[model samples]
Target: MNKSRNWPVAVIVLLAIGLAGMAYQHFKFGEERKDFERRWNLTAAQLHNLSIVSDVPSDINFIPAKEGSGYVQLSGKLKSEIVRKLSQTEPASDGLQLDLSSDSFSIFSFDFRSTKSQITVALPEGLELGRFQLDLKSGGGSVRGVRAGQADLKTSSGRLVVSDVKAAQINLHSSSGKITAEQLEGTLTAATSSGGMSLTRISGDGTYTLSSGHLNGTGITGHVAIQTSSGDVTLSQFSGSGQIASSSGSITLSGQRSDSLNITARSGNVKLSKDDAFRGIYNLRTSSGSIHAPDSPGQTHDVIEVRTRSGNITIR
Candidate 1:
């Protein structure tokens, strides 16, 4: 009977030890979480360019500052160790470079599952940025209300959104991600692989190249070039010259006025729509498909050439 009583006591002791251990772990995790929840503020001299490199899931925002001042406001949850390391890094002469990757946490050996962290930056309005570039390996983000001389945004595999941007030169590249931009001005160059691209209300010379993705845009006023393979191309309300080429995908173009229109396709259909004010010489050709031209070739100064290997051509 005494031995039986001892067994009960031992079991009770073991239960208590397990409860204590669980409580300790819980408390430690809570403390670590609190550390990550803290916000960090940093100020620098007049910045002309900005570069950000992150390899984790993050959200970044660029807000136009109401007050005309050069300042960076960073707020988000990150590893305490990462915050510590960032505090030690020095900013470049022209801007700041942040590399927030798992490699950054290699120096710390604390055994804990890392939580997702995000860092957001807000810039002052009318700051006159010379260059704004972002290189993200994974995750998604957005940029808004940016006014710069040049901007370049690149991502490996995530959705990217940009709006209300006025730049002299804009370059966007994505390996496998969707890109959407609106109210963009100046010269724009966009390239994507296996991801769709959408541009709206653009007023500048633009060039878009895509492989296995769709390209769609509207309200364009300038020269434009589009090249795609296995993806469809569509444009509406275009008021300039355009050259489009595709393979295994259809092309649709509706223009207000165009001085020169050239389209080539392989195994895909080509469709064109124009206003009544359009007067151009039509040169339509197809191998294994029907051809529909708006008008016969004449002495008109403007030219619309359409060529297809195994697809139909329709013009109206």
Candidate 2:
């Protein structure tokens, strides 16, 4: 029994030695990695305009910082030294500039196959900026409880999310990413190419456009104009009127009131609530699909005009 135990101990020691040797070789080849982080503070009241541009795929988050304690925090774990050096914040005379580009080469700018960074921009709590802008090549950006005079947030192929944001004029654009916003007030303009949109409790005049994704919203109280191509438009609790158009998708709306609404669809269905309590002339027409409505078309000031090619029209 003693001899057997000695052999087992020897085998264990040998295995441990082999593992140590492999780890040593791997480390000796410079395969080690180190993360880089930077944090700084600035006066929020001194700055008004903010611009952030990133070329890599990064998660950019904005939060309300402490009073008079605004800061910009950037961190990344990258292999290239140039990328680590380029990721920094510069305080300008009027505002601040943040560039989070890993590779300075503009040829493969949007190729997000290499490194990703996380950025945190902490603004002063309850301090609104004069203007806000973020242009990301291939990343996602999110913010909550922030106010700006005008905000223009765009991403080439990533998501944009905002909550409880109040801006006088807001523009959100995404090429191949989704846009999700809630509790927004003022003039809003949103567009997406292949990504959808989800909005809730928005109180403003808005214009939305989508290429091949869905547009869904609720509790909207504004004169809104919506257009989509090969995507669906679904809204509820809407209390304003403008126009809604779709090419090859459905339009479903449940509203409390409307002044004058115009809806046009190429080959999709239209559904509305019969209990909308609006005395309007519903000019509903379709080429082949059926129509179920509570009122017929007549000359009136309040006109709910609906036209489709080959889809059912239901106002019940």
Candidate 3:
């Protein structure tokens, strides 16, 4: 009984001690944090090829440089002693090639101050790179208004925003935090393990995977392969052939697809909007749920196949 009665006192003493220690440390280190930052800049011959590989978790900005500047510039402030990166020209046949990475001695660190740093890369207007590759971690940011032959951007634990990226092949991957992309081209490959994904005006052949969050798309074109588990799948203005599989969440689509499509839902309702552009042979099946569709193929070679285990299928 005595020990139990004294537990609260012990906890209060420990908390007081911890707070006092923190106060002392703050008094000693407050000024050092202000001096932790330094400005840096690097220049390259051209802005045709670029690679950004960072693990320090900072917001990255891609902006237009001065016209005919004949150089790409990297300007940012180092926010911590361990947050140091350098850009160097890479070997290439034509155009400029630059790679930004951590300095040799400070390749990777767990310094918390580095997470809130910022980086900016400036390129000439109307610049299109041969390849744009960025592999970053957390503290999400935006990458916009650039064209590339191929683009691969990945992040986690923070919102990733992309816009006006025209690439031949594009892959956006994130494990957590929301992802928003728009006005993108190429054969897109987008996936999120546990967070929502939103796309607008995405065209060309594409594939999407959402493990346990909402997946939404608008103005999608070409062939697509989408799969979701325990997350809702919603699409609009979709065109061309595609396949979709939903494990346990709702699937809703409104499109102008007249090609072959195969869809399967384990336990989620599937809904297709009634449109004159949706002409196909309907073959809807379900195990223990209702289906509302045409009994015949509607005299079209295009097949729209749907199967569900215990969910309703709606086609009108």
Candidate 4:
């Protein structure tokens, strides 16, 4: 009888161990699911209407001109502090195209304002393909894939990114945070107070200005202008005549051929290098740094005038 009672107790103990093991596995599974949702949360505010374009036209994509006008506004103020999750999704692989090349249309206008929640905005494919506008006011937000004829972007303390844009005029200004653009065309103007600006594969005639941050560009043509109070300026393969100024940093121009080049620095060095000779009047000055430019080994015709307060000028 004692052995029989002991048997019952042993069975009870084994059952308890199994229950504990199952509970541990359940806890771990829940934790993994939580992490998976966190990284894939890409949410935004988007607008699409059928009335704007009764039938998604093949030749003419986007909204018709006479259809109408509308706006997208986001309040972003939440009532309760609930932990809501989000999941991100990407577009399908099969892309659409336009059959007719002669016709173009302006799709929509986006106006975004945010208060509390963070936002990421995505645009439709090749929209406007011509004329578009974006007006953003918020504590913080991000934008991607925007095209327009004329664009005006201003942010107080938020980050902005614009890519693959074809426009006649583009304007961007930000107080703090970084701005980067790639494959941008036409006349462009960008300004930032405490943030850096970087451009790559840019093709157009444009002007750029910056303060308290770095300004960098590659593969840029046309008239260019850059000024920085306390940052470095770097340009590569920059063609056309332009002016560059820096209050307290180095200025470097490489693989550059220009008609006229002017460089001024309060206390920094200036370096210019070119494989071929360029015809122009060069004015370079520095308060307490050296200026160096090696002349072409072959025949050349150019005028270089340099002045320094307490620095040396070296021409090779």
Candidate 5:
């Protein structure tokens, strides 16, 4: 009888131990999901500009709100301690600024560390903005459906994407990250140190400069000027004039409408497509490579010049 009673107690003790072990494991390795949301009712007439500054890794998305007055919504997942410090906003006479720095003692001390966080911001739709600026240090982000008078986007080491932007002027600068923009209707000025750039369906003039990456564009409506140090260039379906230069990469252009086309390459091939609608005076020359301009149109006032130091030129 003692053994039987002891067996029951022993079984109970074993079960308790197992339960405790399971609880400990769950506490140590279970997922932690923390989220926070904040909303700001902004006066659209008073607020003309919006700026976002961050130092941590974040993915920012901007969507047009359907209802209500102009407002700003910020929602993200981060540590509770970090979330407490995210409430940094300043309203000036001209615009609203949101700074999401992860440094705790930023005012009185110096700390260059940032916690891992994901942030998303949504802006009101149909609100006319005078200026929109996004300055990020090390996070990948995207901006969409923004209609501003002027937009400037800069990032240090993350990819940047902009789409459906309607601005009078748009400037994008990136260091060590790729940049992509589509459906843009403005004068674009883009520069990158170590990343490729791609633009599509652009409606205005553009000036692109790259140090060590490719430049690609399609369906451009206005004048375009491209300069690359060590990367290739490819343009298709261009409707305006163009001036392209490359140091150590090939250049290829295919279009049927242009007032003038000029290309200069140092050590790469240059190719152009000619059609029945092409009307320009051909000036193709190369120092050490062959020059083939088979379909040079009848003499015209417009000029199509292609020059290369040590690469072939083909006009087909």
Candidate 6:
């Protein structure tokens, strides 16, 4: 009996068994993946069945249903190949509804990239819900709503329009786009990089930061700060204490009065004007820029430091 012949037979048997096991595993994985994809596609299709009217005004209305807590979220994207189908309204699915409470709070978000898509949210005459959150995003989606208690809105390169937002905590961000908000109350923080920001009135405490753009606010209360790299920083009526800094642009604080006022720039003018008298530790410094404190009659307990590498400092 040759042992070599028995060795060859055993090797052949092992190879056959390995091939069979691999084939079984490959088929099983493929089936599971296919099933998962099918279910996901089905769920998306159902969500697309929801109402998605182009010309219809974008609005989210919520009435105190259970009175314990409630949530509303709206999110969408511009018409792009990557997000085209995802933005479409689908029928409700088991995963579509993210109900926080058994019958209290709900969250809804979608995507829309159509040329003519707009969203607006309004609270009915009398509705005092607890802990409400809303998020709206689009390539060209305009979001207008009255928010209260923690509201956040962001856009990549679209127009953002918000009005009458009264939240305990509010945050808004936009990238390379335009943002307009009015009558914002509570702790608010709005920012835009390489875009424009215009706010009517800000009552409470907040900060606005910009990379290379403009930030114009009508009224700001409490502590506020505005920073820009290479753009204008203008505040019509700013009260309380805050700091405004810019690199190579003018910072005009018109009719501004703060307990602790601080303005610094690398190569731009710092204009601080006050209608009446103010009292605080004022700190104004600029290099290659001017500081004009004409009507600002306050006790500068800190120091009126002005230094310019290549520009003049003017204190009026």
User: For residue 315, what is the lDDT in candidate 4?
Assistant: 42
To one decimal, what is the Cα RMSD in angstroms of model 1 from the true structure?
8.3
Order the candidates by lDDT, highest first — what do you get? 2, 5, 1, 3, 6, 4
| Candidate 1 Cα deviation (angstroms), residue 272 | 0.8
Candidate 6, lDDT over the whole model: 0.54
Runs of candidate 4 exceeding 4 Å displacement: 1-131, 138-142, 277-291, 295-316
- Write model 1 residue lDDT over 136-187, tens digit each, in one string: 7777567776667898888898888877778899998889899898988889
lDDT (10s digit) by residue, model 6, range 85-121 = 4344342542232211111121322212222322322
lDDT of 3 by residue, 138-219 (tens): 5666788656778888886677888887888998988887789999888999998888889999879999988888889899
All models: lDDT?
Answer: 0.74, 0.79, 0.71, 0.53, 0.78, 0.54
Q: Provide the clashing-pair count of each candidate structure.
A: 2, 0, 0, 0, 0, 21
Q: Which run of 10 residues does model 2 get worst, by summed lDDT?
A: 104-113
Per-residue lDDT of candidate 2, residues 106-139 (tens digit)? 4422322335677777777677778888887776
lDDT of 1 at 96: 68
How well does each candidate superpose onto the true structure, as a TM-score? 0.79, 0.78, 0.77, 0.56, 0.80, 0.59
Rate residue 244 of model 2 by lDDT: 95
**Ranked by TM-score, top first:** 5, 1, 2, 3, 6, 4
Deviation in angstroms for 149 in model 2?
0.6
Model 4: per-residue Cα lDDT over 1-316, one tens digit each: 5688798789999989977866766523211111111111111122221111111111111222232322221223221111231122222122111111112233421112222332222234334323333333333344444455565655656566667666678777877766777777778888888888888877777777777888887877887778888888888888876677777776777787665666666656666675356544455555666656664333344544454454454443
Maximum-lDDT candidate: 2
Q: What TM-score, to 2 decimals, does candidate 2 have?
A: 0.78
Q: Which stretches of candidate 5 lie over 4 Å from their true place?
A: 1-34, 59-62, 79-82, 88-90, 104-126
How far in Å is the alpha carbon of 225 misplaced in model 2? 0.7
In model 1, the runs with Cα more than 4 Å from the true position are: 1-45, 104-126, 296-299
